[model samples]
Target: MDRHDQVLEVWREFIATGKISNEKILSPAIMNSWKRSRECGVDPYQKKVPVILKEHKLKNLLERNKDLIEICRPFIDNLYSFFRGTGFVAALADVDGYVIDVTGDKEVLEMTSRGSFVTGALWSEDVAGTNMIPIVLRENKPCQLRSTEHYCWSQHRMSGVGAPISNPAGQMLGVLVIFGPYEKANPHTLGMVVAATHAINNYFHVRRMLTESQISNKFQKTVIESIPEALIAVSNEGYIALANENARKRLSLPENITGKQIRDVIEPGNGNFLSIISSKNNIMDMEVQIIQDRKPKHYLLTCNPILDAEDNPTGKIIILIEIVRARTLVNRMIGAQAKFSFKDVAGNHPRALETISLAKRAARTLSNVLLLGESGTGKNIFAQAIHNESNRAKGPFVSINCAAIPRELIASELFGYSEGAFTGSKRGGNQGKFELSDGGTLCLDEIGEMPLDLQTTLLSVIEDKSIVRIGGREVVPVDVRIIATTNKNLKEEVKKGNFREDLYYRLNVFTIEMVPLREMKSDIALLARYFADKMSARFGDELIRIDDDVISILTNHSWPGNVRELQNVIERSISVSLTNVIAVDDLPPEIRKKPAAIERDVSLKAMERQLLLELMQSKLSKTEIARKLNVTRCTLYRKLKVYGIPYQ
Candidate 1:
C-alpha cells in the first residue's frame, strides 16, 4: 500500500468504522501528528498552550529545591491528610499510572496495592485495562467511577476519585487518586478534591511562570524550597490560604495554612500593606523596591479574583515575582517596575557622577529635587533612581513629561478627574498621577514647560500635597515626594516670565545639573563601550569596538545634540559599516575633516616616504607611544596625537 493507504489504515484502526480522512497531512521536525504526516518525529500534542511572560529572577535557584522541599513537606502532608482517617486512600500516580505515594489505612493501602496496581504499574490506555487514574491523566479532567464502572471485576466493591495533575505548561504532572468505599463519597468531597487539585496546579504554575520554568513533580519532590519572596494565596477576605515553596520556608507555614488569615503570617513590623490588602480584594498590582535595611530588591505582586461557575468572586489568587540587583536595570528599562534606580543610570560622565551623588543624598531625605539637562541626558533615569533610593522607594514612582503632554489634558492627566468631569473624563473618575503616587515619588519632567494655570495648580500641590480633579468636588490628600526635571534653563524661562518662580523655588530645594556629552568628553569611550554592549545584546551583533579613526572622530567632533547625537551616529554607523572596524570615512559627515593637501605638486617623493612609513608603523596608546618614543606621557598625549601625527 502507498503512504496514504497506510495512514488511512492506522486511523481506521482507531474508529473501526466510517472513513474520516484528515483535511491535511504533514510531518514536522521535532514533532508530527495525524494532521500532518509529510515527515516523521515525536508527537507532543497538548490541550492548551501556556502563556509565556517575564519571570522574577531567583536569588539562588540551585539551593531553593533543597531548602524548599523540607518547607513543603508540611503542606504536602495536608493534601494527603484531607483524606486521612476518612477510611479513603489517596495515591499520587504518574502520567503512566505508576503510583508514587499511597496514603491511608495500612490495610486499605495493601488491598489496593495488590494485583500489580501499585508503584511502577502502567495502566494507561495501552496498559492492563481501563483505569480511573490513567483516564484522568490522559484527559486532564476530573473523573469518578461509581460501582461497576471500574474495569477490574474484583474492584467493584469500591469507588475511585481521580484528578489529573498538570505542569505549568498545562501538561500532565500525574494524577491524584482517592480510592475508597462508594457509600462515603459525596459531591462536596469530589468538589474538595477538585479544588485541591486546581489549587496545587495554580501554586506550581504561578511559581513556575514567575521563575520561568516547567515546574514538575520533580521540583515538588526535590526543591529544598528556598523561595525568597514571601508568597501567599488569599481568598479575598484577607484569609491566608496557600503559601508556595519560598513563603512556606520563610514563614514556616503549617498544614492548616488554608484556613488562616493574613495577620497570621505578618507580625506588625513585617508587612506594610496589611491594612490595604485587608480593606478590599482587588488591587491592579503592587510593587515595592527597597534598598535600606536590606539589599535592593524589586517585589512585584498581582492579585486576581477566583470565581465560581456563577461568576461570583469567592477568593483571590496572588502571585509574587521579585528582582534584586543594584546595577541591573533590566526590568526598569522595560517598565516592569515602573521606576528607575542606580542600576538604570548607566554612565561615567564626571558631571553625571556628581549628579548621581547629589541625587542619592537627596533621595535619603524627603526634599524635592530639580534636574537640569539636555533632552537626551536621561533626566528620567536620574528621577527614577532617586525615587528608587528614597524613603518612599517601597511605593510607586509615577512620571509625567510636561512637554510631551497635551496642554488641555494636562489637568485631567495630572489630577485625574471624575468619569463625567469633562466631555471625555474617564468613567470611573480616574486617579491622577498624584493618586497613583500617593505614597511614592512623582517625577514631573520639563516642569518649566507646564502652562501658567497648571503651574499655579502644581504650586498648590507643593504647598499641600493634595489634588482637586477637574470636575470632582473634594480635595484628595496625596502623600508623595516630587522630582522635577527640565532640559531648558529654568532661569531663562523664569526671566522670560514663562515659568513660575514660586514653583521653581519649591522644586529646586536641591539641584543636579547634567553636563552635555560634548562638555564631558571624558566619558565618551566608556559610553561607547556601554552602548556597544547594549546594542549587541539587542541586535545580536558582535560590534565590539570602534577603530582608531572612529574613536578619534568621536572625540574630536562637536556633538551639537550631546549624548543623544552620539547615539544616533553610533546606530547609523553600525547599520552602514561593512568593515570589522569603523573608519572616519564611514562616520557621519561632521566628524571627518577634509584630507590635508601639500599643493598637489608632483609629490611622489614625499608620498613615497609617507606610504613606506605608514606600512611599517601603527598608532599606540599614549603610554605605549611614550614608551616607544622615549618621551613623557604628557608629551605624547597632547593635541598632536588628536590630529593623527606620526611623532617619534
Candidate 2:
C-alpha cells in the first residue's frame, strides 16, 4: 500500500485494538504517542478541534505571558521568513499546549485556521490528541511528528517539529513548534527549532540576572543614604563614588559629585584620605580642617578601606564628623547642661519673685541678657534657669568665667584661633565658647573683668552676630544667646572705660537683678531648710531639721556672701552637728558671735525687750535660748516673763 493508505490502516488498527505492534512502520516516539493517545480515550475519527479559549480569555492569557511572547516574537518571525513560501507556519505555545503566538504564510495560516490550529488553540494530548506541541511538552525534549503519527484523523495531513523552552531552573516554560504540509518537511527543521529554543531560554536567564542586579544596587544606595554622619566612598584612584546628605552639606559639595576627585571637593589637610589610601592603612579619629563658606572648620575623620575578594584594597569609605558637634557631645558628657529652672530658685520674696518673672519673660525672646548681682546671690542660677525655660533648652549651656581665664588668652578662648595663630595653639585650632554654644546659651560670667580690648571685639560680635578669632581673619557666625553675669555695674564700668558702652546697652537689653539672701530675709528659713536637706543626703544622714532658734539667728545675721554663703553654713552645720536638729550651738562661731544689730543700738533696753519677745515665740527651749543669748536659763525665763512673752 502507498503512504496515504498505510496511515489510514494504522489509525483503524489503533482504534480497534488499543495497541500498535508495527515498530518498523512507525518510529518508537510515534508508537509511544499512539499508546498514550489511546489510553486517554481520544477518538481517532474526531474531526472538529474544540475552542480552548474565547477572545477575552485569549487576550488575558496573552497579556499574562507578555514577556514570553515578546522574547519569542522575533525568533518566530525569523523562522517564518526561512520557510516564507514553503507553506510552513511557526507557532509558540505555553507548557499547557495553548498556542499563544503564530506566524506563517497566508495559505498555510488559512489552512491551519480551519482546524483551530491558530493562536489561542488548545493542542494538548487530551484536546488535540498527540500532536507535536503536546508530545514535546510531555517529554520536555525536541521531536518531530509526521502524517499518521498524529492520533487525530484531521491532523493526518500535517507534519511538524517542536522543541521545549525552559527557564534557568531547567523547568520547561513552553514549546516552539513549526508545522506545515508533510510534503514540505525537512530533516534539519527540528534542529533549527531546538537551537532557537535555547536562545530564548538564555534570554530569560540573562534578563532575570539583570533585574536582580538592579534591585540589589537600589537597596545598597538606599542604605548608604540613610546614615547621619557625613559619608563618602571613593575609588582607589580617589574619585568619589558615593556621598550621603551630611557629606554634601558639611563639605558644601554640589549634587552629582560622583566620579569627581576627592581632593577637588575636600581641601587636602591632616587625615588626607588620598594619603591614607596610598598607605593602605585604616585610620580613625584623625583631626582635619576643611574650608566651608570661606571659613576654616574642623572635623574628625575616619577611613576604612574597601577590599576585593582577593583582599587587595579597591576603594575607601570615609566618615566625617564636625568638630563642634563632637565637642558639644563631650560637653554634655561632662555636665555642661542647665540643671536649674525657675522652680529651683527657692524663694517667694517679692524681689525674688519679680526677678524670676522677669527672667521668664526674657526666656521667651532671643535677646541678650545681663544678670547683675553680688557674688553668690544666684546670678549663675538665674542664667541656667532662663536657659532651661527657653526654646533652646535642649541645647548646650556653656559657662566661661572671664575672670578665671587670663586676659591674654580670653580673646582666643572666646573666639577660637586658627592653627599657628598663637604659640601653643592646638593643632587644627579650637572652637571657642561661641562656636561650642551654637544654637544654645553662652554665659559670660564676670563680664566686668573682661579686658577693655576684648570688650571692643565683644561689642562688634554682638552687633554683627559673628566673631573673628584673635589671629584668624575668617568670620565665623554664631547663633548663641549671650547671658553675661557680673557683680559690678556694667553702666558704671562703661563710664570708667572698663567696659564698652555699646556692649553694655546690647547686653542690658534684658537685665535681671538677683536678690541677695539678706534682702530676702523672709526666704532665709526656707532656703536653710532646703540646703540642710540637700547636705544631709551628701553627708549620708537623715534629713536635717533647723531649729527655730537657728532660723532666728540665720534671719538676724548679715549674710555678706548671699545664698552661697548660707549654703556653706548649712553644709558646715550639718557636718558638725551632734544631732539631726541644727541647734544654736551647732552654728559656726563667726555666725553665733555676730549678735543682732539691734543689740548694739543705743536704745539697748528696747532692743533687749524686742529680742526677748522674738525669742519667746520660737520653739527653742529656755536652756537653748540661754546658751544663744550668752545668759543663764533663769535670766532667760525672767526676761521673757518680764517682757510679757508667753513662757510656752
Candidate 3:
C-alpha cells in the first residue's frame, strides 16, 4: 500500500491494541502525541470537538485578539484564494487553541460542520486529539496532520497545517491554520502558512510605529504654538522644516512654508540671516534687519543647533523678536494706554447723549471716526473714550495734533523716521504715531489743519494700513484704528481745496458731531456740577456744590469755547470761592460781563443762510448739498424756500 494506506492501518492498530508494532511506519512526533492523548484519557472514538467558548466569553476573546485577527485576515484570505474549490479551509486560533475565525469552500465548510469545525471551538490536544492547531501550539512550530495521523477517529478523513504567529519579541500571539481533505494534502501548504505568519508579524510592527510617530508630532506642534515669539525650524540642509503661528504672522508668511529655502521667506538685513542659522555655534541677542513689505524691520534674533544622539547637527531652532514691539512696550509703560471709557463721558442733554451713543456705536467697528465740533468741546475726551471702548482697548492710544506739530515735521511724526533720515534725526530711529498705535487707536487731533501735501500720504496709509518711515525703503504694517477730530468744517475745507476730498470721505466713515455747549445748554448745570466735583478732587478738597445763581449764569452764556470754557469757569470758581459752595461772584469777569440774551437765534439763522448761499454757488448738486448737510432733500428745499434762496 501507499504511504496514506500504511499510515491509516498503523493508526487503527495503535487505537485497537494501545501500541504500535512498527514504530518506523509513523513519525515519532505523531506516535508521541497519540501516547500523550491516551495518557490524558482522550476518547479515540470522539465525533466532534466541544465548543468551549460561550457567546459572552467568545465576544471577549474576539475583542482581545482583534489586532491579531486584523493583521492576519488578509493573509488568510490570500492563502484561501490559492486553494479555493480544492476543499481547503483557512482559520485563525488564539494561543489557547480556540478557533477565532474561519473561511473556506461552501461545500467543504458544510461537510466540516458535522465535525464541529467552526469558530469558538476548542482544539487542544487532549480535547481535539492531535489536530494541526494543538500540534502547533504544543510544538511551537509548523505542524501538519493528515488522515489517520490525527489521533481522533473523527478527523481521519481531514488533513491540515498550522504555524505559530509571534510578535517581534518572539512570544506567540496566535496560530494560523489551513486544512483540506487528506487525499489533497501537500507539503507546500505548510510553507505557505509559515510565510503568511511572518508577513502579519512585520505589518503589525509597522502599524505600531506609525501610531507612535503621529502622537509625537501632535505634541511637538502644541509646544511650538504656545511660544509667543516667532520661531522657525530649519533642516541642516537649509530647508524650512517648521514654523509657529507667530512666525507666520509677524513675517507675513504663508500657512504652509515648509520645505522652502530659509532665504526665500526672510530677506537678509544687515548680515546674511541664513548664514547665522547655518552656523555651528549658538547665537543670542544678535540684531538683524529684515525687509518686509519694502520696509526694513529690526529683530533680535537667537539661534541654537539641534543635534542627533551622536552629536551630529540635524537642524536648528531660530527665534525672532520685533524690536519695535519692545519699544512699544516701553511706550505703553510710560502712558500709551487709554484711561477713559464711555462711562467717563458725563452729559445729560438729549443731543449730547445722542452724540455719546453714536461714539459708542463707532467703537464697536474698525471704521475711521471724525469728531466735528468747536475747540474745547471735549473732542479729545470723546477720542479717548472711543479708544477705551473699542475692542483694541488693550493696545495704545496715540494722539498727534496736526495743528500742534510743526508743518515740516508732521509727516515724520505721523509715519515715523528712519535712522539718519535727516540731519537732526535720532541715531537709531523713531516710530511714528501710526506704529506706536499699532493694535490700538491713533487720534489725529485737528486733522483739518494737516498739510495738504501730507494728506495724500495719510490717505494712502489709511487705505493700505502700512507706512514707510522717512528715508526708509521698507514698509511696516500697522493695525491702528483712526479717530480724527477737527474743529474746522471739513466739507467747506474740501470745497476750498484745503483738504483732499478723498481723504475727507475716508476719515468721515463714522461722523460724530460734538454738540456745542450753547446748543446743549440744558446740560450746563449737570456738566458744571461734574467739573466742580472733578476740580475739587484735583485741589484735594471735598466735592464742591454750585449755587443756583452760578448755574443760571453758566447756562445763559453762549460758550463759544464749548465744554472746555465751562470746565475753566468751574475751576476758577472753585479756586477763588471761600466756601465749598461756588457763587456767581466767583465767575470770570469775561463770562460775567457777557450779556445773557445774546440773540444767538438771529445770528445762527444768518450763518445758516450764508452757508446755504455758498453751497448753492458751489459745484455741488442739490442732492450732494443735502447729503453733505446730513439732511433730506425735502428739508433742504424747505430751508432754501424759507431763506428765499433759488432752487430748481
Which candidate comes out best when scored by TM-score?
Answer: 2
Best by lDDT: 3
Ranking 2 against 3 by TM-score, winner:
2
Residue-by-residue lDDT tens digits, candidate 1, 1-648: 754344444444423432334424312210122222112211112111121112231222213333333333344467666767666776666554554555677777676656445544444443333346755765578876653344334444567777776766877767777767767766666666687677777777777776755455447534434444455767767787667776554344565676778676543444655554554556543543323234333345556777889998777766555423211232244352444578756667667787778879988987899998887877778788888787777777778888888998888879877657767654445657776677777889888889999999999987988887788776667787888998888888999999899888998899888777888777776676677667655655555468765676687776777777777777666544433345455566666553553223444334534543553266645566456544344433332333355556
lDDT of each: 0.62, 0.82, 0.83
Question: Distance (Å) between predicted and true CA of 388, model 1?
Answer: 2.4
Candidate 2 backbone clash number: 0
RMSD (Å) of each candidate, 1 decimal: 19.9, 18.2, 22.0
State which candidate, 1 or 2, has the greater TM-score.
Answer: 2
- Cα deviation of 244, candidate 3, in Å: 18
Badly placed stretches (over 4 Å) of model 1 are: 1-340, 343-350, 594-648
* Candidate 2 Cα errors over 4 Å, as ranges: 1-227, 233-236, 239-299, 303-317, 538-540, 593-648
| Of candidates 3 and 1, the better by TM-score | 3
In candidate 3, which residue pairs clash? 294-474, 294-475, 295-474, 295-475, 296-474
lDDT of 2 by residue, 240-303 (tens): 9899988998888889899998777764453444565456667676666667776667677788
